[model samples]
Target: MGLRGRWYRGGTSKCWLFDSKDVALHAPTREEIPALLSAAFGAADARQLDGVGGGTSTTSKAAVIWATPDADADLDYLFAQVGIGDPTVELGSNCGNCATAIALFAVQTGIVAAEDGMTKVRMRHITSGAVLSGTVPTPGGHIPKSGLARVPGSNAAGVPVNLSFHGPWGQNTGALLPTGNAVDQLQVNGRTLRATMVDAGAPAVLIPAEEAGVDLSSMADNLSGSLPTLIAARASAGLAMGLRNPEDPPQNAVPKVGVVAPAGDYIAADGTTISADSHDVRVRMLSMLAPHPAIGLTSAVAVALAASVQSSVVADAAGQAPLPGTGAPRMLRVGTPAGVIITEIISDEKGMVSEVALHRAARHIATADIDVAQAAELSA
Candidate 1:
């Protein structure tokens, strides 16, 4: 029998949940994990109709979890990104939304005390061995089932989630800029382009849409409809970030693309309209696969850092407004399709970034078990 799941979402993302017992994972090596995850998601077509995948990279996710042996951590959380139009499942990255689900899952499962005070959860990301600390709201001695907080893309009101990661810069790669610079000029389409490359929550290439010649300020609806030029821009960005192999465009990976501009009026994905003056910078976060209407946790972190620094895309809009230099905690409010995402970053004067904090203002919907043992049977 198939395991039960909820395609719930937080901060503009969703995932397929499998109870720890329902799924079984046995990979002799890390390289084998992606296929295993794709199978668990039961992806038969590009849409993954046979499984819980929602057909988009944001919704196409799988989480394997179970109680852990550590006292500080309640459960072990593993996340996988099954490609939208492809069979490759990437396990090298961490999903902040999935990470949020893990913390909420713990309280809903009674793995931890859901008191009125903040519920602290320490989770060891199996892929990275990185310990993540998360705090979710508990109301009336229970995990708050709902709240009124709303994000750019989410419709429901529930207990907003707060997730924090220490040393998020270069999370998978090991350097903030990864290429050792805040800004890099790349040649694509026979034109020289400037991009701010940062590896905060994920590898991202930030460009000013206006400077790139995309008049986002005048676009009636966030520039809907994809063009070859846009796709080429994104593809070229991925290669410049060193995430894609020059020899194999067919086997390329997602490096994420975003265009920033001064704030202006626009419609959010949820149909809620916003004025550019409502945000510090008009920001759009692109997933490796497509343009996300909103932003990702790590990308938001990178935007916050870039906004603080001078000469970068974000900096061009916000000026050289100095943030707390190096190790000083600061917040960056990004205007997106969902509304605004405020991310915090801790940095030092040495230009080294250490931690990224994401404050999501969305209510916790609910949590259910997926029977991990059952999900594993679908693994190839």
Candidate 2:
């Protein structure tokens, strides 16, 4: 039998969306899920030439949505990171970019009724128990394709979809400071480097690019040489964050690694110049061991949280710019290789991170069916 799926461009990332019912029909047991996803994505091949995967980590994601019993949430969204060069699928984390597209999928698939103007869809991530609210513009019961919101890596303009991650701290590792310290001296490759491991929207290890002997402005230029060090640092930090153990092989998706530095002149992926004065901090986050073309939404949230802390590496890289007035939310502009992404961070009376919000755009790309037999044969 064929499984129904939809392709969506959510922010800078793309993913394949499937109804939970359809997924259950295909893979009845959890053990079979990885094989099923690998077959569908044409894994075990670096290029992913036989499947829909775009041959990159950012495009090799999948999401399954289903109705939930909780009254606060309209549906449950499960995100899966499908491997391209290996036959592995990691469901330990959530994809903030794909989370924004779930709202549109719910409305288009009749899981939720869409009203005129903007519709708010509540989602619960099954893996981390994190709740996110996605506000999508639905004019006349149809998602509008045009709007003012523009993401850094995408070429098209669309309505700004506002996503608010509620209670985002400790979504995966169970503690905001998973290592119990704002900063830790990590021993990597015979040298100790200052690192901050924070769990906000996601668990991320932030390290200074200079400490690693890499140029932040030209991260992509040295990605091949720097990945080994970054991956080693990530694995070590993952163990400290309690996301991995010495007995278990490192899962490259979780506890993302970000190399940070003060804003500087850099060349964007589009060949445009990003002025140092335009952005507060420069960052390059990795997805599945490769430098992401753009920053992930959840990573941006983690960066905002890390930057607010006084002694963290991200804060030091951001310099002494004052955050917004205490009572209101503040927008922090983050510079990535693609461009600048604006993230809003709010703090409580106790000065702890209260909420993080950002704007993303989603577009309905295509609706299709996957032949399970064909996928399985390709894997074989």
Candidate 3:
């Protein structure tokens, strides 16, 4: 079986997208979705040399998208993390990056008509129930595919898609602080680590680098020396935050786990020097099992919102300071390996995050009919 798919460069990742209708008609039941998608992406092979999977967590992703009739939301985005070398898919988390991609794709496919100036597409994540509004610049009422906006991570030129998450607090776990504490003591790797478990954009655990006992100074070192520890921490944190059961397998996605450090000068992946004064917090996160080149957009939202809560690990380390005169409703500069991603988080009188804005870029690469073999045939 094959399905019509569109390839898109969203934020810092590449994703293949399909219509929910086609997926419902073509794909099998929920239990067999992993197998079906795996065969399609050639995930059974680690390299994915025979299929479209990019052999990495950031690239080996697909989503089922559709328009919704709900007055509040114009589109629905269901994100899927297609496994790498494993025949499985994770549907438990929301992806701000993919949501950005789907917003532009909606304009391209006429799901939402393009307005003369900046068009707004209200997107709701079916996975985690997070609501996001994306602003797609449609100059002259034309499709905004060709763009000049640039973010920290990718070099690809794409339409500037600004995503604003509305009322994202309690999105995944029904509360801003999932553990009901600004700081929690978590046990992992036979050591006690202090962490802040937040659930604004998604369920996330932010651990200080000192407690995690890993050096987040270098990107390469963060990947090689810190992956195992972070993975273990993710498993332990997930269990502690009630995101996982004692019997279920470890989740590869949420709760988004990351290691945080003070705003320190570091060399970026592109060999550029990032000054400490330029950003608030330095963060290194795991995409799946490896260090993400840049933090995920949802995770960035989590960090930014988490910083708003006093005594949270993110707040302790981030300091919530950006350069002078760089104003939004409120903002924080997150220093990633790629460079800096500024996250704008707005708070209500109650100090809960009411809205968040993340800058991203997306470009539709191509549209094609993807051929997919039976999972059983491939496994055999």
The C-alpha stretches of model 3 lying farther than 4 A from their native spots are 28-32, 321-328
Tens-place lDDT per residue, model 3, 86-134, is 7778899877888889889999999999899889999888877788999
| For model 3, the run of ten residues with the poorest summed lDDT | 319-328
lDDT of 1 by residue, 15-93 (tens): 6655566554344345655665565455546766555567877878767776875655677777777876566776656
Which has the higher lDDT value, candidate number 1 or candidate number 3? 3
TM-score of 2: 0.94
lDDT of 2 by residue, 1-380 (tens): 57788998888888999887888898887667777777788777889877777788899999988887457799998789999888788998788889888876776666777888778888999889999988888888785655677788988775568998887898787888887887999988778989999998888999998998778766446388888889989888988899987999988898889889988888887778899888889999889878988998888988998888777899899884435446578777899988988888877765667789998888789999976556547646
lDDT of 1 at 164: 81
Worst 10-residue stretch by lDDT in candidate 2?
319-328
Cα RMSD, each candidate:
4.0, 2.0, 2.6
The order by descending TM-score is 3, 2, 1
